[model samples]
Target: MTDTALDMSVETGAASYGAASVKDYVALLKPRVMSLVVFSGLAGLIVAPGHLHPVLAAVAILCIAIGAGAAGAINMWYDRDIDAIMARTQKRPLPQGRMDPDEALAFGVFLSVASVVLMGLAVNWVAAALLGLANAFYVFVYTMWLKRRTPQNIVIGGAAGAFPPMIGWAAVTGDVSLASIILFALIFFWTPPHFWALAIFRKVDYSAAGVPMLPVVAGEAETKRQMLWYTLALFPIGVAPYFVGVGGPVYLAGSIILGGLFVLSAIRVLRSEDHKPAKQMFTYSILYLFLMFALLIGERLAA
Candidate 1:
């Protein structure tokens, strides 16, 4: 081929590849995480002791999911640098040059604004305000500031994730309550141990990225100990729903069994030489939370 023709072909290939890459950027919003946020938020809405129109409830859940996705997008945009260095995150959209960082930023901002506005107009201002705060806290406080700064980042930043259930409750009640706060507390306390287990296996990624995860900063032994401690603390809070009168015997029974299993897993992690316990604890944690909320909903529905 002539030199001019070869150059033109190369340029065309580059343009096509660039277009294809943009799709990957959108994937970095962590749709799975958004799904969990939506599900848990819906559970809260369903269990809350109030009557909301079906349409309004659906709108509230939609806003919560979109706000969470926006926060995830912003997190990806800001953490692109660190994400590039981590093995687990190196293939994310911005780091892989699938999408422009500015494009992601603008998309996140647009979603954040649109979600909040829709939520406020359709539901109560209280829910919409909480949604806005959660997004800002995740993007600016957790992703931009804390992720690289301290081992306690997950401990504090977890509040962002904990807000969804409370927002869901508030959307129906039009205010916050002790019951909503308890739901928030459940997720808040659960987050550190859940995340620390992953860090135990992924310590090298955090070390390479200069992120001070619990395992990277506190060492495996200390992280395991903390996980055990948190799991034990979680037991009481997990059962609090029963005393609060929101949960029935079914929920109480399930909470006790699940909480015992969680504590046992944490103890095994502390005792085991291999990382198998941590891995098991991490996987089971997802199941534990899902079942706990599911039982709560079942009780409410049966009542």
Candidate 2:
């Protein structure tokens, strides 16, 4: 079916040729998150110590993007009720009634299956399995369960987002390696502090939705303390690639400096009574992850 037909079917519960607009279809893809997934997967592919056919690599990345989009769509569908009440997610298609929940669910399931199957057939089963696992974890484990039940939701759910690099590495080598796992661990450990910082400022939204985010349950002070602790732990883990031979001087230095800055930001958040420090830490966390990944790829290229 055409994109418009698919969207209309989901939106109006009718199979029609015309729909609201192409943007409606694009909205289902969660393009913002997809960009990060694609970039990280590409970095993983680039840094893998093996050759992948250019066309196959392109296809693998496409599958990863689609899988990520599918998971995001499912998340939006499942969280539509809570999302409708949250300022941050009020404009999402499902919560806004721009699309039907059943339609979103179907669309997500279709994309998830297609992406995994295509990845398996076109590349290898390892990548496909990882992609499938990520989708399942996001949809079932994160969106359906942890998101509503506990503040540590993002801590465990974050693993879904961290799998792209491992999937990309597996696409090239058809197996998991310590290097890929290290990359995964870096993101996994980094997610709590990254998201909890946002929660510190957005705790009101989460509280209204009845989501027990750490900041809401533990109080902002304790949440900030936990953020600091996670950052401290993440520092050595982030820099581990250097000692493991997967990274070089550039990555080692970058990880240390970036990790130190992250810890400092967390400390500032811990010390401040206002939201300014949390806001700064929240914004800088994105840059910290991106720079760390870039340094990894740059070191690989330099070597």
Best by TM-score: 1
Q: Which stretches of model 1 miss by more than 4 angstroms?
A: 1-17, 20-26
The RMSD (Cα, Å) of candidate 1 is 2.6
CA lDDT of every candidate: 0.89, 0.90
1-303 per-residue lDDT for model 1 (tens digits): 798986896676543335435456457558888877887798789878889999999999999999998899889888889889999889787777667677888888899899999999999999999999999999888998898899999999999999998999999999988888898899999999999999999999899889999899889999999999999999999999888876889999999999999999999999999888888999999998889989988889888
Candidate 2, position 76, lDDT: 85
Model 1, CA-based lDDT = 0.89
lDDT of 2 by residue, 1-303 (tens): 899877766786553323335686678789988987887888788888889999999999999999999998888878889999999989877765666578788988999999999999999999999999999999999989898899899999999999998999899999999989988999899999999999999999999999999999999989998999999999999999888787898888899999999999999999999998999998999999889888888878877
Candidate 2 wrong stretches, greater than 4 Å: 1-19
- Lowest summed lDDT across 10 adjacent residues in model 1 is found at 13-22
Q: What is the RMSD, in Å, between candidate 2 and the native fold over all Cα?
A: 4.4
